[model samples]
Target: MKNADNSRRAFVRFLAGSPLFLAAGIDGKSLHRLITGSTRDQGEAFDLIDQVSQDRQISSPGEALDIFDFEPVAKAKIPPAHWGYLITGTDDDGTIKANRDGYAKWSLRPRRLVDWSHLDTSATLLGHKYDTPIVICPLGSQKAFHSEGELAVARAAKAKNHLQVLSTVATTSIEDVIAARGAPVWWQLYHTSDWNQTRAMIKRAEAAGAPAVVFTVDLIGGSNRETMFREAMNDTRTCTNCHSGGQPRPGVSGRVDDRDNRRKPAFANPAPGAPIPEAGPPTWDYVKRIRDTTSMKVFVKGILTPEDAELAIQHGASGIFVSNHGGRADNSLRATVECLPDIVKQARGRLVIELDGGVRRGTDIFKALALGANAVGIGRPYIWGLGSFGQEGVEAVMMILRKELEIVMKQCGTTSVRGISPAYLASR
Candidate 1:
């Protein structure tokens, strides 16, 4: 009984210094009572305390325990419609779940009895070195989640030395994001039907110091995002103030467009019958055309098959971004991680391979690297931080992932990112 009392007292003291406790501004007595169950009846069955205030919600960025910890905070802070759009997947939402579940098919094989006092997590892609292999995947209209939007994300990326891929429909401009990042960033292209406009956007990105252009291709035809529609129905705010174009906003409806009239200066004039420059899909020729149009490296985003991966090389792509548009592009239920090995085999070191979709852990990043991915990407995790606590939250998420990755590296006996390979992983 004395030991138990001492343990409870020590735990309460530890909680007093915890980020969650400090940020939540809980008093020592309250924390002590919460930990001791002082209000409970003596010898009562230990179960859920229905009357206790939930401690899961974080009040500040420092309070976040992991990447997922920010989700509820973000959900609570962001409007219902935007939160729905942020979490939406096409049709049945099976693909979103699959992307996360696919990691279970593989297991890690850690090396034993290796000294790992000094570790490295740096990765290189297209001749550029970054601190970590975790790239910030393109997320459009980040302002819908937070006021600072991509700018805050860029600052966090710069601080953590992670590469950021800016979306075509990003709330902030390319030049500004670059300025905030203090480095060049890759730009994601939508490849709309207007060839002239596409050429102009590509050139514009190159002019803004983007070293590469990632052309997203899986969103052919359109998607049936029932989740976004359902959430938007509950939004009580007036849509017309910003979405005056009589169309669902880009991020809200999953439709890419310059409804805010932000792209008129950089985008080309509308071609015949193609009023929306961000609409329509492209063929392989578009890839070749983009390559021809710019000296910057061209990456083919949303390549999920070995055939498409091979096609990307033939079409003059500098890299293959293995993704399913975060499962928003289709209802195929194919996770990007599941497609990595085959695509890596087909590429055969011919191009840089990167993937993003449902990556929430350091082990997921390690598994991707082991399967021959030069780098990995993340979408919702950082945004969760961004929405909850702006720039600080973004930095917290990056550091958390990096620390987790470092711990995994030490356990696996790998000194650096390049040292991780298929030999360290086994099929489950």
Candidate 2:
């Protein structure tokens, strides 16, 4: 009998070598329908992929996996600067590399023949049950990619019965996004120089029935995203949400002096001479103000330290997301996963510990759960799907991951997410 890790490696290798998956004969629509339909039954992961491939007149799941080769497609479709902004890492990308490399340091210890037929991937976070243990990480400026923008993303999330975290710098208004999803969504907030504006945004979220408020704390200063600047030099397209205030001018430091000296200005076509609101720096008092203003659950994002995690709990944070801002923030920070064990230990279950960074496979989801994350957030991949096929593309991304997770659970001799624990992993 093949071990679980070997099977996964073989599957990945098969995907690498297979040509049939890329052939034009396979209709993406038909393949999508078949895979989604199989989710209802106690379907085996590979079985569904195989069925989809065959129905679509393809050779195998390996061929289908080729669709994820994002670099070439993304490069061709997006402008060079935009591509750089989308793909580049902060400060030489060392931490970005480590974010995924860290995962390799931990190996799975799979058990066999435990009668693991019924696998459940459903998870509940902050008192809400999600179809999958994945939440949509808040990524701003969707209009930069597609005209439908955030609305399209929201529609996709709603279609999959998944949760979405709307960014404070979203192109669409909070009310509009909530309306599009027709349900409560999570809102991601950043502290601004104006307390009134921050308070108002929280009130708006509450009024719109937002389930949680995720305060992003890592971006006290804007990241050194040179790609976006390069792109702006040629393109007129600006991040509507971020540009609504006004474009900042070049400061003495030669960097764009954004109204909020905290964030770096990356968008184009800023309203001329408009006062750039300062973000200054944030304090724990801001957190308390946020907590006092909203009845919704408060989650602090960008936490990678156990001490910060503990401090968040003390400041009335109901949850903490261990993220490196998708490697867009500090370049020297540790990978979010590397800090999870310690943060979880310090949190002591006082707050929900969610993680998001370099999660591209079903095993990645499994790894996070085993190590101690309440749930994981799916970021760039879903957006890549959106960029490729709109709502259908998003659906495909989720389906692929959910199916992979099911297979991982069964092979690891587990029937439910609850069955996952640190015991399932060994230090590499």
Candidate 3:
């Protein structure tokens, strides 16, 4: 086993250095030659497991040419369990595929013979100016991917002058993530049954200079996650799922914000070692409760149906955030993009409409904006970058997205971010 591991690691280095590997990756000719050359390697499953383990331990971040580059590296480098948790949607993965493939359902209407001299991707959301409309979704358990975790993401977003939303379940404490940012960060509140606990979190966020509150309404309880179950992100002894009404064993706890140490945050969300609260659903009363507690602009996330979007706005929501919880919230396979147009029409410009899930490329962002999403939220792409290359890797991913969005915007003959509309879209 030892000999095989060392040989495989060496092969990984060779592949990484080879120019052919840059475009095709390790599964190309070199890999076949190595495996076929050894009789022991023949008829035996080579999972590339050792290579993955080595990459996670190495000092260097893997080579990254684009956002997609990070995915394979992350899967290879991180523990199978951790990577599985990050990438897995719900059962059947219909929503996951939808998020990625749904872009093909519509085509871009590129205007020609127009002035393509210069372009700007600058976007303003909820009165904040971002270099681009790309916002990182509030993904939790960051330390599971990289040592720097959410801090790495915060630094990257600050470096790019982009918006970053911190999950309530973030491994890095809210104050710590906020402290790491040069620009302001938004907070994603997992509204718990205990409104008092929820209020405490909101108050802490406001004091720490969080400009907005993304009240995620999708995950009231645990969604069915067979992938996570199989990957060891959960098990009998370590299942901290809210639906089970049990606490996971003590491990990988990110400190909740308590800057003054006067009052600690009472988190009621499902995370390692935290009790997943029995928060059933958000009501007008709950919305009012949130409003009564904080002055930060509140955007209700997890909205798919038009009636729900309209009701949220009517109940004093500042914006409608459409998300499928990255396809992790339910068994439904419908991607958030499919839900955007109805949401946009029902909200009818009553509030800012932001989207999360399946935002993998620059053209994906273009499609979202053209369909009426004011801003697009990215989840897994940044994590893949962070897991593979740390902070610099994340920064690289953002740069790629910005450059790609700029190129596509120019192709469509649109220069400004808000200038994007249905005019730039055609039926598939």
Candidate 4:
């Protein structure tokens, strides 16, 4: 068995260096099965790539072996400061690690002698069915990562038929994103503290044919993203171009006054010397008001507790997006996955339960669904793809995750998204 494992590793290493490996777009999980065999009796770790070299650089989206491959390429292509913004989490960044670490607590128990073909990954959100259970979490200011930014992401989401939630601080306007996506997209609200501005934004989104408005509640107060501060020190570009109010300094998170109007089109053209419109904590009354103001379904994002989840349902929220703001919000050190079960129970199917944060694999999505998540959202993974190779990169990342989910469904003898349940999982 040891000899066979060594031989498989040797062959994978050879494949890593070959031209075909860079061009063939082979599945990374399949390679893992080949290298680790049916079991890991010796507990050897799965290394997707044991050898890294310039010669192995992927020139196209098809060349990427997994979702992780896009990160390094995105780093190579994006500016250091912008990359820092994308990578940073609050405080010590423990929450980010926790989000990924939380997945290790659960293990899938495969059932044998069952047909696994003809798998259906389609999922329904708010009476609408999408091609995949995976949805895109709203990431503001995509133009910072790529020239086309949200426009590119919109096109990619349209091509793959994935649901997209556009950020209030998105570089592109709601009208443009809808036009680019070729369909109505969900709008994530993060505008001014004033109710009028908020109402106007929601109305604009409605005018654009948005069916839902995701009100993110976690980022009311700002966070200390130390990593972004550190990376900004290395950026010699004229910060005033985008950050006209002032450049970001060490120990100081960028304020709304410091940002360029072009970066946040949602708050574009405010009165001169007027106070900047920023995200603030929304009360239950505020949520009810939002519900009363719009015909669109209201999804309350960033609830991490059963109590809060219950409150969302009480306030007429159509859904609960269980997230820790990708660990970029306050460092709560609680993973969205860890918070999912209780919230799901509290919701009791009263509202749709979706989650985002540290979803890097199809297995992660499967775990969330098993824990009672109706669907899951991904933030950084798709952004890495967008930053690395533009629209094609985004499409590739979604396709890779869809394929991975399908493979896991087959291996676990599950035939459909709704068919996945807690019975298929055990605590590790």
Clashes of each: 0, 7, 0, 0
TM-score-best of 3 and 4: 4
Off by over 4 Å in 4: 1-56, 250-263, 269-281
The lDDT for every candidate, in the order shown, is: 0.82, 0.71, 0.75, 0.83
Clashing residue pairs found in predicted model 1 = none
Alpha-carbon shift of residue 392 in model 2 (angstroms) = 1.1
lDDT of 2 by residue, 205-230 (tens): 78888989999987676666543444
Tell me the lDDT of model 2 at 349: 86
Better of 1 and 2 by lDDT: 1
Please identify model 1 stretches exceeding 4 Å from their true place. 1-55, 246-253, 257-280
**By summed lDDT, which 10 consecutive residues of candidate 2 come out lowest?**
247-256
Put down candidate 1 lDDT per residue, 178-232, tens digits, no spaces.
9999999999988655566667778788999999999888776678787777677
Could you give me the TM-score of model 3 versus the true structure?
0.78
Task: Evaluate model 4: give its lDDT.
Answer: 0.83
Error of 1 at 187 (Å): 0.4
Candidate 4 colliding pairs: none
Among the numbered candidates, top lDDT falls to 4
Give the TM-scores of the predictions, in the order they appear: 0.83, 0.76, 0.78, 0.84
lDDT per residue for candidate 4 within 1-428, as digits (tens), equals: 99987897787666645564455555544555555564332112222342233235677899888898888788778898888889889887889989999998999998777787677899988777899889999998899999999999999999999999999878899899999999889999874555666677788889889999999888777788987776778788987776765566654555332345435777664434444344555578878988999999999999999999889989999998999989999899988999998888888889988899999998999999999998899999999999989999999999999999988888888998999999989989
Off by over 4 Å in 3: 1-63, 233-281
